[model samples]
Target: MQYKPLIMGILNVTPDSFSDGGQYCVQAEALAHAQRMVLEGADIIDIGGESTRPGSDPVSEGEQLARVIPVIQALRCHLPSNLLLSIDTTRSAVAEAAIVAGANVVNDVSAGTDDPRMFSVAARAGVPLVLMHMQGRPKNMQDNPGYRDVVEEVLTFLVERAEAAKDSGIRPENIIIDPGIGFGKRKEDNLRLIADLRRFVATGYKVLLGASRKKFMGAICGETRPVELMGATIATTVLGVSAGVSMFRVHDVKPNRQAADVTAAVLRT
Candidate 1:
């Protein structure tokens, strides 16, 4: 089946990430998890070295590189050509090294604010760049994020960032925008973003919905563990696909792939 909403399996190589941290921090473990995701129908593998969970400290460049590059190299050598590899980072240096090591995309939660060189690296490599909107730096993003109108603000920020990336020599077609459901949003804001995802989709850029196992689900469902949120995650995947989202960044690939396939089938009729 042609995956309608491309499933980007999340592979956090950091030991302190919010979910599944330490579960795949070792090089061998990370590579094995990536291989499992690919076999489970993941179209893209997003590898991140640092923990972007709220209030997380930044990892040094050298450490981050050491964490992700080897796993990327191993996966690139092992996975088929069709499975895209994405380096989930905000640093330009990491993005460059990951691309050279065989990553096909740069998924930046900072949208280039963290590193000016990121745009040039992506442009030079000619790979797709995922620019996400975050109200503030991850360290203090969730510290009472406030907005007059969350959806409109997020949309405006993404449009401006997309244009800025285009102005910086990046191809328009190579840009993808994410509304950042939980990056700096409150529980209500995340719900609103998913409910009105069509506004982002209407921009004509490929919309990537990444509401996988976020804290908002726990707020709504009263579930504490990230793995327990799989049902909620699949629900959002189906909702995003119906709203025209082109991709989904998720932890559980098989369930999300199944959700996307069923949603695509329903929409085709």
Candidate 2:
């Protein structure tokens, strides 16, 4: 099979996300952005209602539902039936509601740690579950993230969570793991994770890289604005493709999709 990585377009419908916050908060805007991404070759659309930016406060489940469910419903009806919709939420209730509202995947950044019922909800829905490795709550995750070995620690954490999900009845093949770049990681830590992504890939579960326009990219490339980091993001996507990453969750779909495709083509040759 060709090694083309899946491109997961990010659609954060919150007023406070780090990047593109409030850009698609309205139903019409969200729908339009999603359509554009789909046209740009997004294999999946990850819709997030809450802002998980560093030092951000959590949104209530009711508020989250209000923000994301209608968007999911609209996207479900408007987009192709085969295009997967992923609800990026940590709360099981919100995940369940999104699933009922038409989402096909559960992307929990906390990896079933924030809500104990998350795995059960994914299992019940029989949807693919994304279990990410976040060191702490978004409010204080970046306060001072420390790890003896960033890659090994995150890898171990994700593996244990995957096992827990399997123990809770979630099928093994449906589980995907994310390293949670920038969520609770320092610049060096984030770089290390991206560089050593193959370790996570070696774990056998599909590995997702969400390093889209992250702060560390800015710190390295000297671009403070998130939107300006599309090139940097594409660089990471290409690096991720070479590292055997299966999926890329990104804000800019077209460029990263092109980069992944080109890189995969070159690698195959």
RMSD of each: 1.3, 0.8
Q: Candidate 1 overall Cα lDDT vs. reference?
A: 0.93
Output the number of the TM-score-best candidate.
Answer: 2
Per-residue lDDT tens digits for candidate 1, residues 63-158, read 999999999999999889878999999999999999999999999999998999999999999999999999888899999998999999999999
- At residue 164, what lDDT does model 2 achieve? 98
Model 2 TM-score (2 dp): 0.98
Clashing pairs in 2: none
TM-scores of the candidates in the order shown: 0.98, 0.98
Q: For candidate 2, give the lDDT of residue 224.
A: 93
